[model samples]
Each structure stands twice: as C-alpha cells, then as structure tokens.
Target: MADLLVRGGTVVDGTGAPPTPADVRIRGGVIVEVGPGLAPAGGAERVVEAGGAYVAPGFIEAHTHVDGAMWWNPDLDPLPAYGTTTVVFGNCGMSVAPLRESARGPVLDLFCFLEDLPLSAFQDKVPWTWERWPEYRRAVEGQAVSVNVAGFVGHLTLRTTVMGAEASWGRAATGEEIAEMAALLDESLTHGAIGLSTNVFDKDRYLKPVPTRLAEDAEFEALADVLARHPGATLQLITRFNEPDNIDADVERFARICKPRGIRAQWTAIPSTVREDYLREQTIALHRRLRADGVDFWPNVPHKPLEPFFNFERALTFQRVAAWNHWINGPAETKLATLADPQWRARAREDWDNRVSSSTSRLDRPESLILAISETGHGPLGISLKEYADREGLHISDALATWIGHNGILSCLRGIPDAFDEPVVAGLFAEPHTLTNINDSGAHLQLFCGSGENVYLLTRYVRDTGLLSVEQAVHNLTGKLAGFFGLGDRGVIAPGLAGDLVVFALDEIEVRPEEKRYDNPDGSWRFTRGPAGVRATIVRGVPTVLDAEPTGERPGTMVGLVSPPN
Candidate 1:
C-alpha cells in the first residue's frame, strides 16, 4: 500500500542517465519503488497521472540568503512553485543564529545591510526568542515551511557571539577570541549545522568590511580545523578574487586549509563573461590543480545572466562605487544634498569612470541601461540613458541625475549588462568541477529576481539552445549538488530515498516576466514571477505545489547529512 503513486512519466533519475518511462511508488515519505507497472499492485492512497511529463528529483538550491525570509514567509513562495525542494541558507557570512543579547541589534542591522532585507521584516515578524546555535536551529525547525532547509553556521555570527561589537567593527579577533570562536563553531556543527560559511569579499551596508573579512589567516585555519573534526562538514567561502593577481593566492589559501583536512570548499560567483575569460580559465586551471592534489574545491557559477533591476532609491548598481555609499546608506535629505553638491558629483563621476574600466562594472555601455519604470517624464520613460542624454544634449550621468532629482524615488532602472557571453556560459556549465548555482533568491528582493533560475536553465539552455542535455542539467541541479552537500537521502529517484520530486512538461516550460509584489512585511515591494510548465512539486511524498499553485500543505522539514548505515 503506497501512500502515493506517480505513473506514466519519463523519469530522469538525477544520475545523468537517459530518461525512461517509469512508475514511482512512495510510502511513508520515502520512495518505495521505481519501475514499470508498479501501480498494478493497486493500493495507492493517491495517484497522480504524470503522463507527458518528466518526473525528476526536485531541485536543491545550493546558495540562498533566505535565512530570515524563512521566519517571515514560511512557505518560501516562488521557490517551491519553481520546483525547489531544499535550499541551503546562511550564505555569504550571514545568518540569524548564535546571537548574544548585546549583539542582537548589530547582527540584525548587518543582516539588513548585507542582504538588502528590510529591518521591519525582522522586527515585526521574527520573535527573536533564541540565542545559541542549537536554540536557533530548534526555533527554525518549529516553523512551518514548504521546502526543506539546511543552514550553515555563519562565521560572522560566531565571531560576533564571541567578540561582540569589536568583531562587527572589523577588529581582528585576539588569539583567545579565535579559540572561543572555533569552539563555538565545533559546537554548532555538533548541534546540526550543515557547514561553516564565511565571506572575505562582502561589506556591510555601512561600507565597512564584514566580521569574517577581518579574520587573520590563523583564524581561518583554526576554523577549518574545527570543520575537519566533523566529517562531511563543508567550508563555504566568498573569495576575494576580484583582483587578477589575487586569484591564485586566494584559491591556494582555501586549498591549503581544506586539502589535508579532507574538507570540501565551495567558492562563489565564478565569472561567465567574455571579458572575464582569463579569470575563468585561471580559475579552472587552479581547480584542476587543487583536485589533482586531492583537494575538493568547487566554484559555483551562475546559469543565468548576472543582471539586477534596481531603482536610484536602492540602487545596488551605484553601491560598487565607494563615492556613492553615503547616498545609498543615508536618508533622502542626505542623498538629495549629495546629488546637489558639485564636488560630490565630480567625485562620483570619477569613481564611475574608474569602475567602468575595471573588471567589476556590470554595465558595458551606458546605452544598455534601460529605464524599466518611472513616474516622472523627465527623460524618455523606457529609453536608455545614452539616448536620453543625446536627446537632451547632456552627459549620460547628468541626464540620469536630473531625472532622479525630478522623479525622486519612483524611477527604476534595468541594469542588464552585456557581460554574459552565451558560449562562455555554456562552456562553464559543461565544465566538470563548476556547480551551477549563484541564485541570490531571497536577498536583493527589491533589486532583481533570481528565484526562477533553475527552471530558466532548463528552458533556455537545454530545450532551446541544446547546450546541455536534460540528463546533465538534471544531474547538475540534483544528485551532483545533493551529494556535494551530503544530503544523501534526497536528490535521486531510488528506493529508500526521500520522495522529493517534480513533474513538469518539457515543451511547455517557461519563466514568466518579473512582477512587483507588496508581499513582504511593512508593505515593502519586491520583484517576483510566476512559473509555468511545472505541474506539481512533492516534498516528502506530499504535494506542496500543484498545477503551478501552492496547495497550502507544508510537508518540508529540516534536512541534514544522513549517518552511514551500520
């Protein structure tokens, strides 16, 4: 007597195998059987006719900033609907655990700044009842969510819990402080953290470096030693490889810490642009070297374009320039004053010019910056800055500034950079060591939407371009990533595995246009989209999404590494 039976679907079993017509039987939240004509045994409590669809392992979102979003929106909408069954949170050195009473305000503020999360969302929605890592895990587990969650103990949280505001202000921890942090990390892993996550590149909202950025080499080695003690514990790093010469050095540092310890290290945002071909090649070569030396170093790369839509009010575009930090972090009056100042304008122009020539700029040409939305007709509503500037006989920067001054906070710009070269991106996907991820789903809520990237890869890359076969893409999203993260019981359509599955029509798949929704706490607006072609997403043998809609059933639970069977 199976709890559920999915029949007549082509099963892509998440092992890079060719699809085969099969019937899957689920009982007691795990797959009981997968073969032809299994439903003939005749006692399925519920049967889903998945004819003309592909039944595959549900997606595992490898990187997300949904640490706080889970507290506010337990359903974690748009994710489950897009076929994500599990998500790894607390990325880029941000998490909501291991808090001290004194460090509460600073940690929340840092989270709000680094992830672009609204402070009101946390203050109004979260209860802030827990402090230690175990308590925090229990609190989140108590919540009702539609997708499974596996979180890393954040390095910033550990540092702040041990050293308080001194760590928040970029002060390097003392030797004793490092020992305390390491001990806490060990305890966190023992309690149930998936791994340890740290960021060496990100800065807080106030333009100050994150706590992990201030850590010395010895501190990182100490933390790695703690990770080494716990088998299957991973080290997630946001490497400071933005500069050319530093790439090899950063990789070597991570490899040194992870190699001898037999720990896996995963780094973020390997570039997919033509301009960064050199960086990408160097990264691949370095990964090969590390792998040959018996180090497991995986570089996470994006399957979609690294573009974000933003408004002048909260423009992450300008945040890259140090001169624009005050404007972004300050109040309206301060931003207005800065915009009005000639000295500030000159400095901003210089900074923008310098960034444009650097490897970090998202925009290749000013004309590619499209005005996505606007309330004022100061400039052309949907035209590029170059067109508006040429029409008004002004510099592009001046034209943008004038429009923002009149439109105020209501204008939005779509910063779609021409950096993502299709051939280079496909090549990266085909690479053996690269992990297809980097969807900053819960973060950048107002700026852009990356939640549908998993489906986007399937529709655009596999179905349309034929760059990657369905088998390879499914493996990339499921079994490969699940194995990397040690979620052993999921990410495969096999007997005794957790029955997290998705059934979707291959020909009809599509990612809808981005829409603005006022769904967050305090009536703040965030960009979202509806998904198509996905018929149903089942978590733990229960359908969380049916026919592209939430079924209001939360069968998801906290998942971690499974102990080896004796």
Candidate 2:
C-alpha cells in the first residue's frame, strides 16, 4: 500500500473536541502523523486535497445486517460514499454461522423473514462453507470488502445448531441444551465474536415468535455466565419496542440476567418519536433508573425516522395483521386468488378493524399510503390509496387489493413516516449512555433505504436544525460507537490509530433520494439510495470511495472487539 496524505482540512479528532486545521499522514494503513505543513515521505505517496472540508474519523455504522449481504455484494454500495468505513453486523439474533446442515435452511429462513431480505438471494448468494464461528470468520476475512466488519454470535443461530431447528422454536431448551449453547458461545467468544445478540422483538411471517423468544431464564443465565468469563465481551438484546407495555418487564429481565453477571448490556432502543412521547418518557425514566443503580445497560436510538415501503412479493411488515400475513405468506396463485376472494376481503377488513395496531402497520390509514411503484406499468401511479378508493367507490382494503392486483404484486405502497422530533433527538444525542445511529442498513433492502440515512445526523441535526454541534455529532458517530463496541484501534484521527477517515464539506452532503436497483441474485429488485457527496471515505489508508464514486478498492478486514467493558 502507498503512503497517503490528507491536507487542507479542519480536523475533528472525534473526541468531542473543537475542530482544528491540520493535515493527517498515513503509512502502512496506520496514521503516522497529525499536524499542519506535513510533506509527503521520500517514498511513493498519494495526496487527497480536502480543501474547505471537515476531516474526521471514518463513520461507524453502529448497527446493521450486512452479514449475509457481504458475501455477494462485497462493495457494500453507497456506504462508502456516505463515509462509513466500519459496519457492525450479526445484530438482532441473525448471524449466519455456527450452524449444522439441518439448521442452515431454518437459520436462513428466519433471517430473511424477520429482516425483509430476499430468501432466494440468501439461499443462492452466500457461500455457506463454515459451521462454526472461527471458520466463518476466516471465510469473511478472506473476502475483499469496502468496510471493516465486526459481528456477534447470534442466539438464534446457536439455539438452532444445538437443539434441532424445529425444537428450538417449540419449547425452552433443556439443561443439557443450555449447557451445549453456553459451550458454543464460549468457543465463539474465544475465537473472535464480539459477543452474543438475541431477539425478543420479532415474529416471522407465520406470526411465530423467534427461537430466541423461547429462551428461559436459565438459558439467559448460562449465556451471561459465558460472556462474563470473556473480557471485553458484551450482551445485546432486541426488545419489544413496538409493544410499549412490555418494555419495562423486558428491561428488568435483561438487567437481572446480564447486570448480575457483570456484562455490558445494549438494547435495541429508547423510543424517541413525536407520536410516542408518553412511551419515550417511560423508557427515558427506566434508563435513568438503571443508571442510578449503576447498571451497564445502554439503549440505542435511531437518528432517522421510520419510513417503510410495503410490498407483497416478500415482506414481514404485515405479520402483525392476520389477514395480510396469511395472504403474504401464501403461494403466488393463492395470493392472487385470495386477494379477489370475497371471504378473504371480509376477514381483511375485520383484521384491519380489530387486530392491527395503529403504531405498527399503516394498513388502517389508506390516506397516508402512496402507491409509489408499479411493476407492470398498469397506469395510476403516484396517487394516494385513499384517492384511488374514493374515485373507484371501493373500501380501503379492497382498493389496496385492486391496486396490487392490477399493478404487479412487486409494486410497493410507501407509508408517510412519523415526524422527526428535534428536541427528543437532541437530548438522546447528548445523553451519555444512549447509543445513536441505529440504522438497520443491509437488511430491509426493499422496505427502505438505510444506506444514506446516517447523513441525516450531519445534515439535519448539525447543519439544518442545529440540534447538535459538528463535534458532538461526529463524536457520537465515531468515538462513542467504537468505545461501546470495544474497537480500540480505529474511530479516531490520531497518530498510531488505524487509518479510517472521511472528508467532505457539510454543505455538499445530503441524504439522497432512494431508487430501485435490480442487482439481486435472482434478478429481483431492491431499494437503494445514491451517494451523500462525501469527498472521500478511506478505510485503513485505502480510499474505498473518492470524489463521490467507488474506487473498486477493498481494504476491509474482519475486526473484533478489543476492549469491551466488563
């Protein structure tokens, strides 16, 4: 690798300190110097002139699901352009390792269903050459990727591997099963896994709770005990954020399991939305109480609002609604037949009226649903579903069925997102124990574009609304996440640190509009956004993205937790 010099930029060292004018020099994928008036070494050197730009440590994607996607799409498109140099995957109990041949299909099925990922792509694209964590790590490290990758050992993967896939979902593990799971977790942590991630928040297309939900208190205790033995290992849980009533009990249970074991526990989030202020207050109070008691539990928060696109081809968004879930999980012929079936339509209306939660699915609110995409160009696009129903003199559910039937099933209905709450976001941004930037990028590819969502933190919060200063925003994106994940080597712009950095003028970057891309292995399409106009996104001294385009360079390596809090 050639030596590199980044010049003429205001350096924000990612320590929440004020920005200062400086130049950074790198050699052998490590920062060698940080000062102004730095000249290139006598050897070969590449220079990036970052005039009038902010130079900061490369942004870390704190939460993502690129574990399976990385196998086929190694470039991790648009992430490089958004200044993301590191990505953390294996989240929400969806890692793709430690599986037996019998568990492979079940593991992939659960991952695809819950994540809204294409099942065909996962079945065909990923090279499942390993059945253990160490082998999985070697397979990933051998691949050339655009960003550094770290991951956790998924609880679902572990359960399915030890206790047959069918039994894993049916009942709580036996004592022997729990012991086997603990042994596997210990082996994974000893190998390189950052920690363990489990889910209590999801149901599959069949409305069945995930296998992790079957885990008992003894199971959790066993896993926590294993994590306690490993220094710098953490425990991650995805709780029921949608069901606000159960959140307090979930937090208390998790604290009991991991807090006593002396392991840091990171949960999916603390609700922060304009529509859910009451629930947000409850969660905030819960977190405060945990802090007062000195519990090492950190809650994550998403900086972007929830904007989802619903489609029938393959989606879990309607799993909460019985009528829709049944129709969506059926075969193609069954789907078309049931959409026109009068009995089915009646049941759908009943489900819409009584079963669906307004906070989750927007099926009840046709007015806020836009007919965004048309797979067959059957006409009538870009109109709200309510308008279509009004013009056609049809019920809302009937109108939706007619639209999807007329246009191809691949057509999508886009929901208007909740309003972004500036004050709530600002408070969480400044909160010491809160983990920001929980963008589920890599998963839900067709549902929403998570690629450029991180740009909103810099664009909306810092530049537009002034909710956060640039220093604070950068620190939250870089240093804070690195520390939480125990990645001691990178996430800062200083000598001896890994050469991971981004450069761009704040005014030049904005979250780009989402567009469709037909790049899936099965010739299917997915939603993806374009660049955020970042001048450069360098990973380990190599410029993966330069001048807003990919450089076709793959310098990423398999990174692991270096110093996780005990």
Candidate 3:
C-alpha cells in the first residue's frame, strides 16, 4: 500500500519533456507510480491535493552556502521555496568537515570572511555534536528541512586539515602531508561527500602568491585522480580566466588533470560580462578539448541576473578599507569616528577624485560601480552610485564619498571595468551544453540583492527581458543541475523520483526591494528581499513553504556522492 498519493498534478518531468497530467503515488519517500488516475491500492492512506501544481523533480542547487545555514537554521527558507529538495553544500573549496579542535586552517578565516551572520544566536538551539564529515552527515539525518542536501569534500578544507590556518597560506604541503591529505579526502568521499571544490577568487581578500596559488601541477592532478576513483563524481571550480585562448589553456590543464582519473571538472560561471566574444569561443573550445581528452569538463553558465549584497561585515566594498580596517571591521563608534574624521575623509576624496579617475578615460562608456540596495527590498536594487548621487541632488563624486561614509558596510557589488554584451550572456544560457545557476543563496545573507536570485532570474531574464524559454529556464534550474552532480533519481519527474516540487502563479513572482529586516545581529543590516509571484513550494512530498514562508517541515537529507536506489 502506498504511504501517500498526489492527485491531479501537471508533471513537467525535468527531462526537458513537456508537461503531462498525472497522479503520482508515493511510499516510503519514493514515488511508487504515476499515471492518469488509479483507485487506492490496498491501503494507501494519505492523499495530497495537488489540484493545480506542476510537480517536477525538486531543484538541485549545485553551488550553495547552506553548510553554515543548516548548522544555524534547520528549516532554511528561500531555498525550500524554490522547490529545492537537494542542495550541494560545501561549494567553492570550503567545508565544515574534517574540522578538528586543533586544526586552525586558512579556510576558517575564509569562512569568516564569507559570512557575517550571527549564527551563534542558535548556540543553545542545536548541539555541536559531530567533529568529522560522517558524524555531521549522521547528525542531520532525520532533521526536518524543506529539502535534501549533499555534502562535498572541499579542497581548502583538505588543506586546512593538513596545515593549520597559518601554514596553509604560504607553505606547500610536504610529501607526507600531501599523502595524509589524500587519505583524509578519500575518507571523506567514502563517508558520502559528493565531490571536490576549489576557487580562484576570494571576494574579499587579495590572495597573494601562496601554496593554494602555487600548488604543484601534480597536486591538482592527484586530486583529480581521487575524483576519478568515484566514476560519478563532479568537480566545481572558479578559474581566473574565461578568455578564448587563456580559457582553452585553463580547460586543457583541468581536463588533463581529470581525464586519467575519469572525473568531470566544471567551472562556477561563464557570465555575460565584458569578455563575451572571448568567453563564447573559448567555451566552445573547452568542450571540444574535453571531448578529445575524454574528460568531462563543462562550465555552469549562470543565466540568472546577479547582484551581490553586503554591509560592512562580509565584503566592505569601499576601497582603501583594507588600509583602514578598524574603521570598518571594528567597533561601531570607531567606524563612525573614522567616517567623521576630516583627515581621512579629505584623503579619501583626494584618492577618488585624482587617483581613481586617472584610470578612467574621458570617453563616455558604461561606467562600472557597485550598485546599492537603497530601497530595502529587491525592487529598488541595482541603483548605481551614479543614480544614488543624482537622486540625492549631489555630484557623483561627493555622493560616492558620502554614500560610503553613511552606508558603512551595506553596499552591493563594486563594478569592475568590463565590456557588456547582454546578448552573448543570453546565448550562453540558451545553449543546451551550458546551464545557469546562481549559487549565492546561502552565502550573501546581508550584503547584496543576491538572496532572491531565482526571483530576479525568472522575472528579469525569462519574462521581462525575453532571454530564454520558460521550459529552457526551468530545465536549467531542474534537470541540468541534477545531471551535472549525478543525482539522477530526483532531477526529473517520472514514476520513481521524489515528489519535490514548486508551483508559482507565474505573473505574481515579482519582488520589491526593501531594507534589511529583523537584522539578525543587533540590526546588522546586510540585505533582505521579498518576491511577488511564488504561490506555493513543496519538498519531498511536504509543503515546506506555503505562500512564501517556511513551514518547518525539514524533509531534507545529507545526500551522498552516489545516486540512491531507484
């Protein structure tokens, strides 16, 4: 007898297949069968009223920061609302595993640099039980999350274990240390870590020439060998270049590192930025080279709109803050004092007006500057430094300075000079070989307009801009992501997938920009958003979010590297 049944769902199987009207049956967490309709089999007791929902496979967020969120909040919101049943945590070479009481690792600093959330508030809420990867996995086993999650053994985490935080930055691991690291990685993989992750960028710090930078070509190759040991495993990396020729070399090196080990290595993003022509040609070349080397290498192109939010805690966007740390990462009074100091203010004005402008030519080009989330929610987002200054009736230069002083840490992304070609970015996501996912959901809690990535993505690109087909957009978010990570069973809706899904009212999904809310840490403002059209969301046959708020039914799992029984 089935444990539960869902009747009258429009199933858009994540296989890029068209929707089909059917009733899905579930038993013991797995979809037992699906067809037009059927009478109760024996004693199927419960039934879900899926009158108008489109039941597809739960979303697979390949890149996420829920490793910390889960430790802090069990019923993670926003994530479940996207129908994300399984999220791939420990992305970007950072992990909460292999942590030891004595292991002071550079990744720890990296993690601190990443999130400024006051998760310590929940210290009395959850027990800090596990010290290893497997134990942590077990600890989360029965927790009721709106979705399932898979853990990965991060590369920086590997380094952190072998060499404590201080040593990891400058010194390369000795041969014995490397072997020890390898053993630890193998153990983690066996314990259910899905794959490996490493990043080339540290949104905050300027990485110097260090061991992570100078890892012997052989070290990464060895890591790839470890990945090869798991045939279905995947790799997520953020490289330095997407230029055609340079990207080719990068892909070549990565593929060569993975081919012998039979691992698939994918880059974090191939966004439509200033380097579009180079990125497209280079991407095509990368696929070609991977084919030749028999290496599974593909870049996960983000078709989503992006806006990284922040306040002074995570990434303090004001330049020269490094030279003035006490003014930023320090006490509030000190920060306010620094802002009020005439000497520093005069110096900053001097630096921006004279030195900063020297780099920009007189030519009228699309100026690059980080946009601020002034209006509070996602609606008044992307308001540029230029716009903000104009709105306040001041010169752009004066406004920029005052903005930095007044806003402190609550600014979004700083614009780096790059050419823009929206069409190229659209084409990239539109390609079948390329997929889109903005893996920033759990990370930028306060700084940017990044939390509601899916909202901006669906509304902006697909609906407003007409960049992609709704089917293609949904496919990228659902099927493409699952396949990349080797979670075959839950990617598509069929007779045997989990009944994880979402149903939005389409036109109602717009999000209005609002200021930081219920500031977690003494009102430490980062960024907050609310979407318009999300009607209902479900996870593993449970309604985790109804009308866009968390329902506290955590039906998630600590997913393993290998696929589960069909």
Candidate 4:
C-alpha cells in the first residue's frame, strides 16, 4: 500500500515530456504509483489534495551557498519557497571543511561579505564539534533540514587547511602538497560530496579573507586530476573570465584539460542581455567547442538580475577601488577608514570609470540602469540607483551606504534599461544542453529580491512571459539540471524516483518584500523572511516543509559520483 497520496494536480513532471493530469502515490520515500486516478492504496497512512496545483519534481539550486544556511535557518524554507528541493553547494571553491576547528573562524569571516553571519549566530552558537567533512555532515544531517543538500569539496578549504591564513592564489602546489590536497578532496567525496570545485577568477580578491583567491594554477590542475580519477565527478568552474570573449579561451582550456580525462567542466554566471549580441555568440562558440571535443560543459545561466547584499562591514569597502576589487577582510574600523579617504575614493572612481565595462558590471550606472528592485520601504521596489540618489540629495555610493545600514542591506536589481526582451532569453534557455542552474540564491539575499525568482519564472516567464512553456521551464529547473549534474534517478516523476516534490499555487507565486526578521544564529541581524511559496514540499517522500515552513524532517543525504562507464 502506498504510504501517501497526492491527488488532482497537473503534473509538469520535470522530464520536458509534457504536462498531464495525474495522481502520485508515495511509499517508503519512493514514487510507487503514478497514474490517471490511483485510489488510495490499502493502508495508505496520509493523503494530500493537490487542489489542482502543479505537482512536479522539486527544483534544484545547481549552485548555492547554503551550508550554514540550513543550520541558521530552521525551516530550511529559502529554496523550497522557490520550489527548490535540492542544492549543490561549495560551488566557486568555497567551503567549510578541510580547515581545522581553530582555523574555522577566519574561514567564516572571509565568507562574511556574502553573508553577514556574526560569529555568534552560526559559529559561536553551533558547537564546532567536527573537524572533518564526515563529521560536519553528520552534525548537520542530524538536524532538521527541509531540503536535500549535496556539496562539493572546495579547493579554498584545502589551501587554507594546508597553508594556513596566508594562502595565496599564485603559489604552485608542491609534489607533496598536490597529493595532500587530492587526498583531502578524495576523502570528502568519499564521505558524500559530489565533486571538486574551484574558481579561477572569483569576485573577491586573492588576499581577501575569502578562500577562492588562494590557489595556484598547479593546485587547480592537481585538483582537476583528482576529479578525473572519479569517473562521474563533474566540475563547477567559477572563473574570472565569465564574459563571452574571455569565457571561450578559459572554458576551452578547461575543456581541453578535462575532456581527455573524462571530467565535465562548466563555467558560471552568464547573465541576461539583449544588446550583447556578440557576447551570446561567443558563449555559443564556447558551448559548441566543448561539445564537439566530446567534452561535457554547460552554462549556469543567471538570466536574473545581479544584486549583491552585504553588511556595513563590507558595504563600506565597496566604495574604494583597491578594496572593491582587491581583498580587504579586516577589522571594522580599518574598512570604514578606507572608504572615508578622498584619495581612495579618487582611485576607486577612476578604476570604475576606466575598467570592467558598464555593460557587464553595471559600473558606470548608465542611462540604461533602470529601477529594477529597490529595498526602499515606501517609495519603490525597482528604481535606478543614480536617479534615486540624485533626488535623495546623496551620492550613489553614500546612498548605498546609508540604505544598507537602514535596510540592514541595500538591495538593487538592475536591468539592461534598453532592448531587453523574453525571446532573447528564451534562446539562451533553448540551448537545453546548457543546464539551467544559476540562481545566485543565498549570496545576494540581503540585497536582491530573488527569493521569489522561481515564482517569477513560473508566473511571468512560463505562464505570462511565454519565454518557454511550463514543461520547458520545468525541464530547465528539473531534469535538464539533474542531467547536467548527473543526479541519476532524481528530477523525473516516475515509479522508481525519490519523491522530492513541490505543490504550488501557480498564479499566486511571487517575490514579496518581507519585513526584516532579526533571527540569526549570531546576535546580529540580516534581512530575513523570504517570499513564501510551496503549499507543500516533500523530500524523500517526507513532508519537510508545509505551507512554507520546516516540518522537522531531514531526509537529505550527501550525494557522490560513482565511476563512469569505461
């Protein structure tokens, strides 16, 4: 007898096959029955009425940084709200393991920019009882996590663990160190991690407190070789050259390096743009080149807007040129002083005015910068920073500073003020080979209103925007994503598949601005209360979140890649 039954919903079914009306029967955490009308099997313990909502395999956050997120957040509600049932973390080569208990403090502080996790919230509060990945995994799994999570062994952890806080990006791994790093990575993978992760050119500087910048070329290659040894292991290459022109050469080199070794390599963060015709062409060339060489690669397309969030500590550093691009993780007073300096400001403005084109980084704040999504309470959700600052009688940087403190974080969702349309983005998505899994979730949490992006995709993109049909978008979110990452039986709604499912009110799905909920493991505060969705989301056939809150069921396991076919 099926343990649970979900009835009366149109199943989008994640396979891109086509949506059809159906009912699903769950038993022993597996989809035991799927048909037109399955009466409750004898002895069915529980029943859920889908109420004619969409019942599909839950979505995947192919890339996310939620290792600490699960712990600090009780409900584990963030991604599930967006229909995300699983996540691949430790992307961009940043992770918590491989560092000693004594060294975890600096590692957490380095990541504090993307997250304002006061030590008290996560570190100080949660007992640092484990030093190894297995130990860490057990501790976390022991808790109630509403979502299923799989992590990669990040190179950042290896370097800092082996070389201490002074780890730099350029230092070549020694013959001895190479083996040591590989051994550590192997251990993590064996313990349940998916693969090895690295960032050739991360957003922050090498010397900054972050771990991405702390490895040499030799070190990365050695890490690659380790991945090669594990057949089904995939590579998530977060590189400096994410643009088309630069992306090709770097991706080509990576493909060449990984192709022969039977490793899959993919670059991140191809943002949406209509005017950048040449850039899209370059991206296609790179994709085609990798495919032609029998190398597996795909883009983690972030068609969504780019809005980073940070606390006063790091927001102040954004004003200075050297500190902005370079690494600047230090005490609070030093950061504030750097921003206040007139000479520093001059250098920063010059750097911004001359480098990293306004096209990609939105550096120049052109006329094209429109009001996308603002954090202002009463005024507007999406407004041009320049115009808003001008009217408010403050510089853009100053307003950002003031707003961040006032709002707990200044959020901006900017767009390509001109010539942007859905069809162009649909074209990017149509390259089904390019597995869609690039939502910068949890990173820009404080600054961006992306918590409801999945809703936006469902309602706006699929239903109204018409970029793709519900089947197509669901494929991008489900099977296509799982296919790229090689999550064998998941992402498809079938008899043998794990029942990680989401039921949502289609039209009601949305991104909403919630009042700041100051609940952090640390005594500090960060913008909380993400857009609520997921009338019901189940992980491994267990109800983890109901009506958008954790139900205290942790059915998630660390996933690993087995050796591939010879």
lDDT of each: 0.79, 0.86, 0.61, 0.65
Model 4 lDDT per residue over 1-566, tens place? 12678888888888888889898888887887888888876664577788758888988888777767767774654566666678888877777776686557656765554443454555655656677888878876776666777787777767767656654433555678777888888777767777877766544333343454545556667778887766567888876553555666667767767776788766864555566666666666666766777887877665554444333334322322444544134555465456666776566555555554424555455344554433455344455667667778865555444444344323344445334446767777777667555655555444443454566667767867777888888888887777777676678888888778888776756665534555665444455445456677777777666766656666765554532122
For 58-159, candidate 1 gives per-residue lDDT tens digits of 999998888878878888878888899999998877778777778878888887877778888887788788887788778877888889999888888888
Give the lDDT ranking, best first.
2, 1, 4, 3
Better of 2 and 3 by lDDT: 2
Ten-residue stretch with the least lDDT total in model 2: 356-365
lDDT of each residue in 79-175, candidate 3, tens digit only: 6655566787877677777666455234555565555444343233445576577786787785656678887777777776777766776677777
- Which should have the higher TM-score, number 2 or number 4? 2
User: How good is model 2 by TM-score?
Assistant: 0.96
Give the CA lDDT, 0 to 100, for residue 195 in model 4.
Answer: 82
Q: Estimate the overall C-alpha local distance difference test score of candidate 3.
A: 0.61
Tell me, by lDDT, which candidate is best. 2
Superior candidate under lDDT, 1 versus 3: 1
Model 4: pairs clashing at backbone N, Cα or C within 3 Å: 120-522, 121-521, 121-522, 201-240, 371-382, 371-383, 371-384, 372-382, 373-382, 374-381
Provide the lDDT at 158 for model 4. Answer: 70
- After superposition on all CA atoms, what RMSD does each candidate show versus the true structure? 2.3, 1.9, 5.0, 4.4
What lDDT score is found at residue 105 in candidate 2?
Answer: 87
The top-ranked prediction according to TM-score is 2
